[model samples]
Target: MMERKLVFGVAVGVAVGACVVAAVVVGRRVKSRSKWKRVVRVLEEFEVAGDTPVRRLRQVVDAMAVEMHAGLASEGGSKLKMLLTYVDNLPNGSEKGTFYALDLGGTNFRVLRVHLGGQRSLSLEHDVERQPIPEHLMTGTSEDLFDFIASSLKDFVEKADDPDQLVARRKELGFTFSFPVKHASASSGVLIKWTKGFSIEDMVGQDAAESLQQAIDRIGLDMRVSVLINDTLGTLAVGHYQDPDTVAAVIIGTGTNACYLERTDAIIKCQGLLTTSGSMVINMEWGNFWTSHLPRTTYDIDLDVDSPNPNEQGFEKMISGMYLGDIVRRVILRISQESDVLGPASTRLLMPFILRTPSMAAMHEDSSPDLTEVARTLEDILEITDTPLKVRKLVVKICDIVTRRAARLAAAGIVGILKKIGRDGSNGIAGGRSRTDIKLRRTVAIEGSLYTSYTMFREYLHEALVEILGEETAPHVILKATEDGSGIGAALLAASYSS
Candidate 1:
């Protein structure tokens, strides 16, 4: 009886032990499942976040439109200090002279000299020399960089000796310094900030004219930076000097900006200063404009997050040359990474930003037989060798979306400018008194590489303008490409100041 009782107790204990072991195993499984569920939720959120580049791009565009309108209709008046700079000092009728223009745009520097006659014809006596900025100098000290430029100018000057003497006074030069500057006068301006992939350490507070002059002087060259101006200001000056009706200038390239003539009286910001002609040139660093009415995408947001300056220049980040190709790359990369549409692995583009603006321009203009242009451009830019036709088509679609979005938004900005100029309306400032009855005839003198190089950009921009302004006034509003307007325009500004 005792033996049987002991066996019964042992069986009960064994049963209890088995129950404990089973409970522990079930609990562990349940905990693991809960953890996995949390992880899946986070992953889903990420996927959603990454899929909204279009929305983000639109948001940025809308912001830019708002800022553009504000800058155009800036405080004192809807006028952007739109003053016609007089070229009083240009060689009088029937005189001949050689003028030099140094254009310091992003990515490259240009040195050009023109031979002009009193009969209103100009010829390229010498071809312009273009030199890319060395990798070291771009990120080097200001003095080292300037010294390099000075040396280049010295070389260019040495090349200027003529076999046949042309009688003229000291040569005058126009320097197109494409950067943000505070112009105290036409002869000089202070560099406020450096943009355009340039980050030289010593150039922030230096006078741009003085820097160029010092470089020239160091080379023992005898020429003056007679016209120190930004490219937009140069465009306006050159446009107005060429034709008085040309009142505004806009540059849409790797970056985007606008400048126009404005009345001195309208600028309440500078109450104490006196302008002899009651006007000055205003540079609308309009890239920072932000508002609604634009489209944004997931790729755009990703770009903004990765950009150097986040939450600023939201509009430019969306549409400029520097970012458009990058956006396309990001979108393709995302689609390749997540979706089964790409078939297999992503193209191993060794460089992420290699798909530059020019490549984008090339892809956009590609119309070769069998769409080989598009295929070749994609391969060249992304280094994707032997890409299948399917992938090529996908890339082309992405390019289309990006380009169309940019063109459409760019049109909106132009329309906003026209609206501000009152070409579409009769809401005249001062009830259409004081100034001439301009009567809604406005001209936009455009300058920049993208404007010049892109195939259908101009047409699409015009289409958008027509959509906004209607077909009637679209013809009345002119958008013409002003070649080298900035260089000559700087000299014109010098003349205006000297006068």
Candidate 2:
């Protein structure tokens, strides 16, 4: 009897322990659910479902067109720069002979040589070399930097052939200087400002083409900068070479900008400018474009406020490849703070730019049954662990939301350009012109890693265009991918403008 009583006591103890464990588990789950609900509330503010309908997008399009007009009217008139590219003539596939191109857009520069066969056939040979600009040189005298570039070019030219090509002829080079410049002519422009982390003080208010030419002369290199063009103009030139119908070009890599052919008469600020082609390409510095129509959440506002250039490039902050990953990190950081579902808030999440766009793309494109890639990224980037399947799915949902919003906004911007150019509706850009007179086919040349490498982003942009334009109008517009056309296009420009 005593033994039976002891066994009953043991059984009661075991049952009490089990109940205690069950109660603790339930309490933890309740707490987690509360946190999750808070995260959902935060996400709801960023929802683009209701904010970006067709009607709202049309308003954005209209705003963009108005801003373009304002910008073209005067300097510093609107958020859009609307700088004139001075490219009156695009490549017509008749460019012949050998030409060279020098691209100085970033820390690394590219030297390209093209042998034009005429009739749209050509062979290209190129060498990409990286030379880190010394920290002092970036802020030093303009001559110092240009001299460095010229010396590098001399080295590249010396290695062109076995001493024969070096002395063959004075090579004409198309210089793609990707910066804000006020063009005096096709081969001359004054540097307006330095961007992309460059801060040369003396470079401003100086002739960019002449500086490079002087540098080349100092180095004794027999190269003439025949045409000075921006990267967007170069890309457009390549597109025009391939297809005459191509009227616009966009670059969506680390940053976003576009250029398109504009009637010379529309350039009200430059009344005296003349070109034989009767049209000019205007570089729409679209990154700075902002409007109340853009759907902005607290996250986007915070990003802008905290950026190095606050309240600048607001559109780029929302759309470009450079900032997308950081935006995702901000969202995840908020989620981690609100919920222990992802364990604890990570120190890595506090760091800026810890999660790059490529990694974000990988996580968004993860197709594993368990979402192992998302898990891995969380672990690797944020040091978060033990995330449940549902939480992992939530991360994916956040990515989709951010990516979709960016893409749709980009589509709206593009349509705005179309509306300005008289391609969006049946009516011409003049507002009252007959629809029957307008051609149905229009092509836009696009370049950059985001459009070409990120499959989902491309799809989202395309889908948004369809939604905005509808089935009938969308079919008439095409966004053609032009790979590495910037270099080739510059070479073509050199060939076209060679004296």
Candidate 3:
């Protein structure tokens, strides 16, 4: 009996020891889980659900309208530099002829020849050649850069047909200078500043059209720059040519900006400006637009601080494709630092723009049950390994939150434009007017890779527009994708402004 008692005691002690061990293990896991939960809570703060509710969006709309008015009121009255594009007339599909467009927006410049057919029955023919701007030339003298462009144009023109034969006609070219410019006329503008990583010191304050023309002359090319326009105006021009109802244009790729047709009388700064159409395309330069109403997060603030142009392009930093992926990276990096779910802090995550917007889009779009693409992106971009499915899901949620916020904010901006034009409400620009009195359809011409290439981004933007505009009024507002509008629209402008 005594021996049996001893064995039973020994077994009881072993069971107690196992229980203690299990408790310790469970406690550690619970603590780890709690840490992850904290990370999730931090991420949730970045969400737009509470930050950009419908009420807040309405406020954004109001603010946007006010800013538009302020910007149009004077040169420096608001953050929005409502620069005049001097494009008094948009293409109306009556243009008939072969025109050339030279696009110098980014690292590559495209030379295009477009054949326009008049009215509804005319067909369009275009041949485009893209050439990479030499790296040295980007930072070289303005003359050198323009010379290179002129030489390329000459070569392309010679290849197309006999240059001498065209000498009698003197081919027309539309120049799309994507940077900020102070327009002197439809065919000329002075460069205000260069953006998008371009740092040509000599280009500022110079006449961009004149420089290009001088280069063309130096190369003995018989092409004249008939219209000097920006990419947003080009987009609006093309959209108008396709659908006359398109009143505004927005670009949402590396950067974001919008342009809209405004009554000449509304441009308070430039008095006595006369145009045949009685309206001119106003480059909103909305990238700089800001109000206290913007739902900015810590991540956004940090991004702005570190950006090359701090305190500038606040809206662009939040919504543009160039910065969205970095925003996701920053969120994930924060989580990794605060928890063990992502394993360890990665140097790759520390690198700026290491995770591009496309990768984020891919991960966000991963529909697999296991989220294989998310896991793969994590491993490839951040070198994060063995991320549990839950953690991978968390990463996806981060992407969704960032992208959704961007898309929704963009929608609000569009709504703001509509409001300013008196298209959002029933008043229709005239007080006491009924909805039925003026229910004309409105279309916003949008270009850039974010709206065209990113499927999820586009869907979210569309969904947000419907939510903001309501189902009844949403159908009246259309967001049309005008791909390569910058290039094609320039050609159309050349035709419209032809002498």
Candidate 4:
């Protein structure tokens, strides 16, 4: 009886131990479920916040048009700096001359010599030399930076095939300085501020064309800075050179901006301004554009707060290539913080901009059955390994949400430009005109990697345009891609305005 009792007690203890183990296992599964639920909630919230339904996009379009009008009405009237570029004539291919162009937009600058053959589109020749700006020079003195550019321009000109052209007459150059410039003339513009990693204090409020001219003189180069324009104008010039119907130019690249041909009378700030064609190009520094209609989320807020320039380039932060990947990163980081589904907290995910836009695009466009590209990108960039198929799918959804919003917002902006010109067929949101009454063939010159290289982005933008303008009206508005606008287009402008 004593032996049996001992055996029964031992068996009971063993049974109790097994039951505790099972309870713990069940508890862990429940906890995992809870964590995953939180992750899903976060994603759902992001999606809802980022939703750009047709109605909301139309609001954005109207807001953009209003801001454009306000900006054109007066300086400092709105966030949009409707700066005038006194370009009365868009090049019609009648320009026949050997002109030089110096493009200083991003980290790299290029010098080009373009030879235009009096006729249209038949004989335009160019030779380009590109050089990366040195790191120290970006923050260096204005004189030093200009001197470096002038030195490069000197070297580029020495190798030209037709040296006689330089000796026969003073070389005219169009300076495509892709920065915020406030000026009154086509030949010169004052640097309002520097963007694209340049911060030359002395250059601010100073004439950029004059600085370049002074440098050219110091370096013994015989070149005249004939026209001062940004890359947007360059794109417009190049686009109009190819097709006269191109009325506006848009840049959807690392940075975002647009310039459009507007009637001289429409610019109310400069009331008596006159142009030969009765039209002028207005640089809509649309990157700094902001209105309450824009959809802002926690991710965008955090990204902007952490950015070097907070409260600036608000629209650019949402739509430009520079900030898109980082925005996606912020979303993924939040998800990781909320759940262990993505495995142990990836330290790299905490880092900013480690996952670039190209990588994000790769992940978003992954079409494999198993989403192998998404898996690889996560592994390679974020150091998150072995993500299950479901997790990969979730990542893809995040990318789509972010990119789709950006593309749609960009499309709204395009429509806003059309509306400002009375070519969008909406007639300033009154919507009273018949299709034929407002139907017009309008072409917008677009340049940059976002529109040309990213297929998904391009498609989404096109889709939004169709949704906004409808099938019949959308067909009339064209988004044509213009190449080498900053390089060759500037050369063409120099020829047109050359002395």
**Which numbered prediction scores highest in TM-score against the true structure?**
3
Candidate 1 C-alpha lDDT tens digits along 1-499:
9999999999999999999999999897887566445434433443454332434433433444344344434453322232222222322223345666788867778776665553433322434778888978878887777777778866876676674423334556788888777776666778888887889868898888888888887877766777776787777765665556665688888888776655555444555546665556667665665554445556677788888888777768766888888877776666555543334554654345768877776776666645687777755555455656655665666676677667667766665554444443333322333233334567778887767778676666676667655566667778878767655655444444432
- lDDT winner: 4
Quote model 1's TM-score.
Answer: 0.73
Comparing 1 and 4 by lDDT, which wins? 4
Residue 440's lDDT within candidate 3 is: 73
lDDT of each prediction vs. the true structure? 0.63, 0.84, 0.86, 0.90
List, residue by residue over 18-77, the lDDT tens digit for candidate 2.
Answer: 999999999988887788888787677667432577777778888988888888889988
Model 3: per-residue lDDT, tens digit, 7-124? 9999999999999999999999999889978887877776743267777877887888889889988889999999888888888988887899999888999999988868732235
lDDT per residue (tens digit) for residues 1-499 in model 4: 9999999999999999999999999999999889889989999999999899999999999999899999999989999988889888778888988899999988999999988888778346788888999999999999999999999998888887775765756889999987878876998888888887898898999999999999999998878998988889999999898888888999998889999998888899999998889999999989999988888999999998998889998999999999999989999999998888999999999899998999999999999999999999999889999899999999999999999999999999999988887789766643444557556688999998989999999999999999998887898999999898888889989988976
TM, every model: 0.73, 0.92, 0.95, 0.91
Q: Which rank order by TM-score, best down to worst?
A: 3, 2, 4, 1
Runs off by more than 4 Å, candidate 1: 1-96, 106-108, 118-127, 131-169, 195-202, 215-221, 347-351, 368-370, 378-394, 425-440, 486-488, 491-499
Model 4: worst 10 consecutive residues (lDDT sum): 429-438
lDDT score, candidate 3, position 409: 86
Candidate 1, 329: how far from true, in Å? 2.1
Clashing pairs in 2: none
Error of 2 at 474 (Å): 1.3
Q: Tell me how far the alpha carbon of residue 60 in candidate 3 is from the true structure, in angstroms, after superposition.
A: 0.6
